[model samples]
Target chain A: MKKRGIGIGSIFYGTGYGNGFPDVSKAVAQLKSDGKIAIYVGATEVGQGAKTALSQIAAEVLGLSVDDIVFINEDTSITPDSGTAAASRQTYNTGNAIKLACEKLKRDILEVAKDYLGLNSIVGLTLKNGYVYPKTLPEKRVSLGEISESLESSLKEEAVFTAQTTEMDEETGQGAPYWPYTFSACGVEVEVDTETGRVEIIRAVLAQDVGRAINPELIEGQIDGGFAMGAGYALYEDLKIEKGKIKNNSFTNYLIPTSLDMPDIEKVIIEDPESTAPYGAKGIGEPVMIPVAPAILNAIYDAVGVRMTEIPVTPEKLLKAIKEKEMTYNEGKN
Target chain B: MKKIKLTVNKKEYMLEIKEDTRLIDLLRDVLGFTGVKEGCGEGECGACTVIMDGDIVNSCLVLAFQADGKEIITIEGVESEEEIHPIQQAFLDVGAVQCGFCTPGMILSAKALLDKNPSPTREEIRAAISGNLCRCTGYNKIVDAIERAALYLKRGK
Candidate 1:
């Protein structure tokens, strides 16, 4: 692992689409020829499963299973220039790139299938378990190995596809729609300790409008993970920043949500598949985090009569607020 | 450096290490169990949590020597060969993993709770993992996964 692998340099291509990019196909072919493998582009799985999503995209497009895909995403030299894993764009953007490559491979295979099977159009060909079959003739199938051999015999169609997306404006922060967005709504119920200023999440319902449920189980996992992160942001987690340096860099000062802190979460995956996505799937990376803080805040307000607007709503803060409310009530009586 | 032996996930390891080395480091760097990660490297975040003698303790705070001669269980030791441990499987099935960085620790925390009390109320499960901070999915699904796993474990499956 390179020391700079997780640095800011790996995140932005430029400002938007063509920012930190590489000659994708050339890199892939060259890497393969050199016995180098395609590392799944992005940061390590650190809990977001960027690698899994990337593999799903490649497999769906290449007409292969996720097991066949091996990624070496940690290295800088061998992989495509995948920006950061933040904001959930790995699947949204990188998946599309792999999907595009897969589509190309599929088209080329269909042409071979068309010529060999005496068919004119490749429109109705569907990929099933690495085999191509026409809807009318589901029983008739051509193995991917056969197509691979045919392609290898004819042309070296071994290349990777690269994509570029634009960013927000430098000054105005307004630009063409930045990459597609993933959306979700978090509904939460909390119980506040009237005495201790502790906020307990009793129950939570996360309704995510993911462009597609590429992997339903994984999608839920993303939401669950986000919920914990968000809950921490709301009730417990705080990075105490003084100037720009973190004062509470250690865990002792910065409080995070524990299992005792969370409520029962019912993850609702609303799949509104995006055609722009590899398989109608949009990235759920940041969206899961986006709504969590607000949801927990709302729940806290609902739980307690006092509407505490600030974060980490520590017991001390809550106690002060309660006292202030009492003082205000006494003054009103006078 | 004093030599110490510890049983981790049913396996024994002997090491000669400094006093300041954290159990989290010992597990990941020394033991080659990268599944246990350091999110906060402090006790506030349960990302370094592991089961020690059937209770959940943040591996970050436990000194390497303190963990010495104790029976410890990391995420890698949670499951048998044929199937995922109940907590792990429930996490997957319930969508409890997103980035999966905090997963091993969170699962281990849940395991600790279930081991002590096989049938935990929802509140108990939440209290169990409150130390773990996940930045991706919210704690809703994680709690759900724990509840589901508790049921399965209680059923003896």
Candidate 2:
């Protein structure tokens, strides 16, 4: 156990996200000897890639491959009591915790590195491919096995962290603000069938401001997922709620966009690395879905002159608007 | 209970199930294949889509007995150990999965479409996966992934 350099910083307003920067080499050493690591951050994969992202964070800190990390997304037993993996906060908040733990581990390893080579700064020490090396001397790299040997001789300590923010002004729903806000916008074009009231999204161009992308492929996957859900919300998807009961609890009653309802989409990734994140990456999970519903709603109005305030524009609703407009025009002509 | 011998992912599994047992249940509970999920448990949502003899069918709608002696392909069978299925890779590469609950079914539906028509128009691709519902990502990316997969398969890569 040694003094660790760890700082938790709030990155954005309204994001309810904070991060702890950790030392990587030490965490790996601890992992090598500890056999298993526990995490309580309330990030659930649920297909949002939170598990993978968190694993990547641990892997990056410990100088291990993504496979070396195992995240317990479910079973609250092993996980930290952080918040849900929503608001694009997991990558920022939970990732920081992994970094903090890694920092403490790094401190332990530094002591070992000092005693091993009798040096003050491991500045010349480069961590690459799961090995620590003196940059000037490539062959002078210490294998993880050797580091683990040192960890077993040394005393160990717990790495605990929690990311938090103050509650909002209950009346106005405003607070200190999102610690970090991921911004995005989408441009959509649609073709509305005058006869059938079927709206087909012709093309969609999206621009997202992700603080940083931990995994580019995964980021886009999140974006695509958001769009699908949003598309369903727009033209063909709706949850039928009647008498406070979920009428469309089953898929039959709830109409989500199918592959048939898919629209042509173009993804534009914008990266503004947040200083607080690992490699300056922000969370892209929830932001993908937040702006989409509104974007689609706006696009529908753009395509058809009618502004359907409500969502899931059923054909009947669109037809009713069309008829109302026609009647108004006819009355004027008369 | 009737004994149903089905071939899934090139492996034969003999299941003694009730006649009313949906293929989805057989795959999930009986066979321990969680890849084929049950979102709606009805045909309305394509969460339980699987390929049967090169055609996509909702496993929830198909009775387990109907799948007896049938060639079934779940998402697990789509890929060899060496590489991922073209559709799955496309989905991953192009960002098609989120809350991946609907992904297996969505990919299978896309596979069925591609098997029937190698080169599908945008409309056709849309028609192919139209049954599946994804709540996280908009359908735009799913369609993009399918379109990309079609090109990848055409190039024989």
Candidate 3:
């Protein structure tokens, strides 16, 4: 017989560096000859799709297609200082910087258009689809490429965004440590074999509040990857060490969840936009993993009534715990 | 050092290498097929999975001498100059490629499975790529890509 149970876990993760400032800078430049926009930021894409997401933000601001925005990122010499890709700050920090830079570039384009078109007032001018036009009069419009070809200089602008966070009090250890916090809840279903103490996760449903999802597909990918790592942490992965030396350093010994080990995952995204963030987007990278382990652990306890505190809840430990719990119950009855 | 002749990616090559050289090193270093990544020198991660005589084998575990006369296929072999393979397209369509470290190996494993069984169940697909470890995407999209690739193959797309 198989015993199945379900459990839930929730978490609140603070974005940006904890108790420290996070900075992001972006530069937007238009090619003088081709009028193509290039965005430069030092944000690394370690499978979180930072490049695609930030490019989307720039495209939204510049009124250009995402394909038209060329990203020059992760190169220190070329791109400005966008801090490390940790603490889930790229989407919020770098995104805002890119937005600001694009906004500045748009202003520069309008300034150039006002002078070139010989218009007295640039009130109703708007940038749309690589063209500048008056809101009411579409005929009196000029292609951005034409403006660039006519101008002697290219359009270039840069902006920096620094996230503000209060330092933790030395005596009280309490203060606003980060800019924004992302909250998430995960529910897991599991099956426990009482004889072997093996716990198999059957399904996982994660509900995350990501101020806004710039790309829903990318968000789902992050969530799914995070859940796999979380599942490995809960039941399969163990880094053995002996006398301060590492053991089980190879993949064969240090087990990660394989395709066979993963369970069905359901994602529920809740959008609670952040006013300060670009496109009202917050970070979802780290928050997706926070609740997974606890949810699986809770499911295991619900199934077999064993409180597993250690990670990698291996068969030996779980079996021992189960036996100990049964013995304690029998002793009390006797 | 020994002289060995093998067919790789439908091209034949005669090379001089040490008997102990691993197939992964031969493919990546000697032949410049850098698509074959080595995550673990051991056979566990399956990051170096390649097709050898119509079956998937971990390239890191196979000695170069043992590969003599055996036809080998790496990720580079899966696509032509004009178009990518149906499996590669399926991976892209299903959003399976992420960090892409595990993509080449995972695709080869799927290829091996699909070559043997054009119509595989979800569980069979999972079991086929069980040896391949991907730190990104949680294997869900990869599985989806494989299933979609199977459909494409069945429809002769």
Quote each prediction's TM-score. 0.75, 0.81, 0.96
Off by over 4 Å in 2: A1-13, A17-29, A34-42, A62-64, A67-75, A120-123, A153-175, B1-21, B25-35, B76-95, B137-157
lDDT (Cα atoms) of all candidates against the true structure: 0.68, 0.69, 0.89
**A1-334: candidate 1 lDDT, tens digit per residue:** 1000000000111112333333232112111322122333533466667677767776666556777656657577656565656556666666666665556656766777777677768889877676778889977777666665555343223334444455556788666435454556777666666677666666677788777777777776666666777767776777878888999876567765555555556778888787666688767765776677776666655555566779877778877886688789899999
Residue-level lDDT of model 2, residues A173-197, one tens digit each, is 7654445556777666667776777
Q: TM-score: which candidate is best? A: 3
Top lDDT hit: 3
**Model 2 chain A: worst 10 consecutive residues (lDDT sum):** A1-10
TM-score of 2: 0.81
Clashing residue pairs found in predicted model 3: none
Residue B64 error for model 2, in Å?
Answer: 3.8
CA displacement after TM-score superposition, residue A236 of candidate 1 (Å): 3.1
Q: What digit string (tens of lDDT, one per residue) describes model 3 on residues A172-243?
A: 999999888889999999998888888889998999999998999888888899999999999998988899
Q: C-alpha displacement of B7 in model 3, angstroms?
A: 1.2
lDDT string for model 2 (B10-84, tens) is: 999887899789888888888887899887766777888899988889898999999998999998889988999
Provide the DockQ value for model 3: 0.81
